[model samples]
Target chain A: MIIGGGSVGLMISYYLLKKGVKSIVIERKYPGSGNTYKCATGIRASFTSKEHIALMKRSIELWSELRDELGVFYERSGYLWLLSREEDLRTFKTYVSFQNELGIPTKIIDLSEVKCLAPTIVIKDLLAAVYDPLAGKASPFDLILQSWRLLVEKGCKVLAGVEAKKILLSKKGILGVETSAGFIESSTVVLATAYDTVKLLEPLNISVPIEPVPKHAFITEAYRDLFKPLIIDWTTSSYIVQTPHGNFLVGSEIPERPSDKLLNRLEFLRKASKVWTKYFPWMKEAYLLRYWTGYYDMTPDHHPIIGPLDDLEGLYIAAGFSGHGFMMSPSVGEVIADWIAEGRPRVPEALNLSMSRFKKGKLIKEIAVFG
Target chain B: MDSEKVIVCRCEDVLLSDVLRAIERGYRDLESIKRLLRVGMGSCQGRHCLPIIARVLAKTTGLRIDELNYPSSRPPLMPIQLKYFVSDGNEG
Candidate 1:
């Protein structure tokens, strides 16, 4: 049984079905109605760590074959990480070298090259950029819907609008899950519930480092061929990508605030617009379309917690994705399923993703600006 | 009724009577009224409805209009068909 039918849960459900494991997904709200649907849908392989790079490589492969494997729309629009400082340029160059070693083709391009790559980008202060033609975007809602249909076809049950109140555990192991509507008997249970994981696991005394922080994004009125590629500027923690529809999908990190309120703060809009204008002056004239906020389940290391809990025998976790779960869901799902079915994951290093790190006080430190 | 006066969000179609009813319901803040009636979740996404909703909410709640916060915006800015979104073309 899977609690929370967001991208991770839904993807794991599909993979489990493919492996002939019957499963049921219980969601408090509708599937894809949570943080998954609110994602910026950025798929990128630019990471400072080996594990993240490998995970993203696997995810990118799956995404490329999604149309054939799952019959979903996946695009390869590429991503460009803009750097304005010498230190950032050096860091990106080191990362590019590591990526090249892993057979991931990433190039460190000059400002002129960056202009050629994305003409709409304001190249005045751009020192260098790491360009990966493999990175792109996809719709999380569509992917969830398609996966849900496939799960139904495979005879798996999905209960939407039903909340999993508690995990039924005995001395033997997890008996099943108790939901608002009823109970289901299962030996295995996975919590893929994103931001709510911390709250949900409070009863069990599992202290996850995850906190729900607000992130906001906006779209500009459609402009004719304004920008290409997902442009991420590290200085501002701002990312902008022109959708196929010609509207610029833009987002930036907001100052941390209390999590319960879903209201859009005007201060965030002003800050985001300022960043946009700094990056692309031409965008100043673009009409503001709409803005929305979503919760980011941030971890101390800015990496996701993906493995099982030592205290709970049958309860596994795939939450605390920081802000990058949407891009990593495909690989995370496959890895978790392999671990559950085969008794060990094909990626042995993924076992390090267990909650023991937090208990042992071993925090993985990386230079992540947006988390 | 004037075309501009049409209420799109049925939950908060603030007739004068509805305002009095909200006051009777003991709502004393614009935010409280919006929460109760969902005055801001329509297709216009609160763009055309919020000013009026705020006014009614303020009058009924016995609060200054400036005290009321603006309603938030939701995503999909302009809702398009799923097919159009999934298709590999540049049209929106």
Candidate 2:
């Protein structure tokens, strides 16, 4: 059984089905109603760590294959990380070398080259940018919708509107889950329930080091495409990308608030607009369409908690993606399914993501996280 | 209503047929259909298309419109120009 029907859960279900393993996905709400739909939809493999780069590099390959199989457009428009500080440039120079060694084609481009790639950008204070041609965005809507359709067609069941209340345990290890509907008898269960994964595992005394850090994002009305690449200002953590549908998606980190209410603030609009206009003054002409808030399923180390729990024989976790869950879903699904089926993850790097890493203080210190 | 000619979401140019097709494809709820076909995501923000789609869904799925999960709505009921929100040297 897979709990949580977001991209991670759905992708896990998809791969499990592909392996000829019958699995049931239990969701409290409808699929894609969670963080999947709320994401900024940026996909990239460029990172500071070898583990993240390797995993996401594999994810990008899977995403390409999924495009043809699922009949959805995985837009490879690429990503450009704008570095304003010299230290950030130096840091990314080392990161690019590591990424290149790992077979990811990422390069540091100067201001003139950056301008050539994105003409609308104001080349004023920017030092340099790391460009990843392989990185881009995908439609979360179609991905989930298509996955659901295919899963059902393949005779796999996805029980929507049913909440997994608790994972039922026996002395032997796994009994199944006691849900809102009733009890499901499954020997193996994967918790992909984002921050809610903590609540379910709490009763079992499995302390998941995950926090739901809320963030805001908004999009403008369909406008003329000004830039192709998803451009991020490194210093400000501000990002803007024109979607394939022509809407300019703009998002930036918001200041910490006392309350974690999922509400859009007027201050977010002011701050994000300030960053956008600073880089591209033409963005001031754009009309605000919609603004919403979603939480990042953050872990202590910023890396996701994947792999099985040592205490529970049949329990596995694939949650705590920080903010990159949607982008990493493809590879995560493949890895988790392999771990479940074969009792080991196909990739060696996935072993580093187990929940026990927190107990051992072996946190994967990831620096490429968005605020 | 001729589903092809009948437009449900005017902002996104979604037809009644489009919504019907989404429903036929098993997107039973308003939220799923909204994301699948962009049914209610537009300048109007589902204010106009939601009721129509809900009625359509209710009629087709045999579930009450109230029973189906409605998509969440937020502020700025209408699309607002960004110039209107420009800071006037007050915000520090």
Candidate 3:
């Protein structure tokens, strides 16, 4: 049984069913009604860390394979990080070399190439950009729909609007989850509950240090595609992308308190617009169509916790993705299914993301997190 | 008015037939329907579309319209420009 019916949980069920392993997914709300829907929609393997680059590289491969199967319109439009500061240029130059060495075709493009890629962008004070042609954007809604449809066809049980209140455990081993409705009897339980994973496990004396941080994004009215790739102002950690649907989706990180509520702030709008308009002055005329918020299931080192709780015999976890869960779900689901069915995750790097690392002081930091 | 031609969400150009099709496709909730067909997500922000959609949902799902919780409304309850938030000497 899987607790939390977000993209991660649903994808896990998808792979598990493919592996001939039958599992049930119970969600407090509808699937993709959470962070999966509110994500920046950018997928990339451009990272400073070897662990992230490797996993995301594998994930991008899986995304391509699953695109047709899931029937999602995935546009490999690429990602361009606009560097306005000298330090950022030096940093990205090193990152580009590192990413290229890791088999990801990420390179530093000059200002002239940047203009060719993102024509309407204002490149004043811009040095260069780190471009990853393999990175792209796709509709999370379509992914959710397709996954849900596949699960239905597979005859897999997915109960929506049912909340998992507690992880019912016995001293011997696993007992199942005590949900809002009743007790579900299952020995092997996977907690993909995001930040709420902490809450459900607290009763069982298992502590996963995942914090729910509020993040926001907004989209503009549909228009002609002005840019081909998702552009990020690296200095401010703000990004803008003209989606295939022709809406320019924009988001940024700003100072705000972490709250469970999906609260919208005028401050976020002001800060995000200032940075977006500074880079794409043409966007000033674009009407901000819709704005919304969601939580980033953050961990200490900004990497996800994926693997088993050694203390419990049949318990597993795949949460604390920080902000990249949606993009990483495909590979994560496959490996996690392998772990449950075939004894361990196929990828050795995935073992590093287990909860035990927090206690072992083995933290792999991912520095390329965008707002 | 014919369900096929009646305009339900003018902001997104969604028709009454579109909402019915979504409901037929297993999107029984307002949020799911909105996401699937872009209903109640236009400049009016569902000010006009939601009530009608809710009633349609109620008629089909056999649940009262009030039983259907409206999707959350974010800031700029009405359509407002981004510049307005950053405008100098302007009190919001």
Question: Every model's DockQ, to 2 decimals?
Answer: 0.08, 0.68, 0.54
> Chain B TM-score of model 2, please?
0.88
Best by TM-score: 2
Alpha-carbon deviation at A283 in model 2, angstroms: 1.7
**lDDT tens digits by residue: candidate 2, A115-147:** 988898898998899899999999888889899
Most lDDT-accurate candidate: 2
Per-residue error (Å), model 1, residue A118: 1.4
Put the candidates in DockQ order, highest first: 2, 3, 1
- Chain A TM-score, each candidate: 0.94, 0.97, 0.97
Residues A242-304, candidate 1: write the lDDT tens digits: 765566777877667646576676666666767767667666666665677788888888888
- Tens-place lDDT per residue, model 3, B1-92, is 79999999998899999988887877777877787787777778888999999999999999776556568777666666666655674533
Cα TM-score of candidate 1: 0.79
Candidate 1 DockQ, CA atoms: 0.08
As a TM-score, model 2 comes out at 0.97
What TM-score would every model get versus the actual structure?
Answer: 0.79, 0.97, 0.95
Candidate 1 runs further than 4 Å off:
A257-260, A369-371, B1-92
Give the per-residue lDDT of model 3 (tens digit) for A241-352: 8877788888888876555576787778999988987777766677887888889988999999998888898898999999999888888998889999998887778888
Q: Between candidates 1 and 3, name the one with more favorable lDDT.
A: 3
1 or 3, which is superior by TM-score? 3
| Consecutive 10-residue window with the lowest summed lDDT within model 3 chain A | A254-263
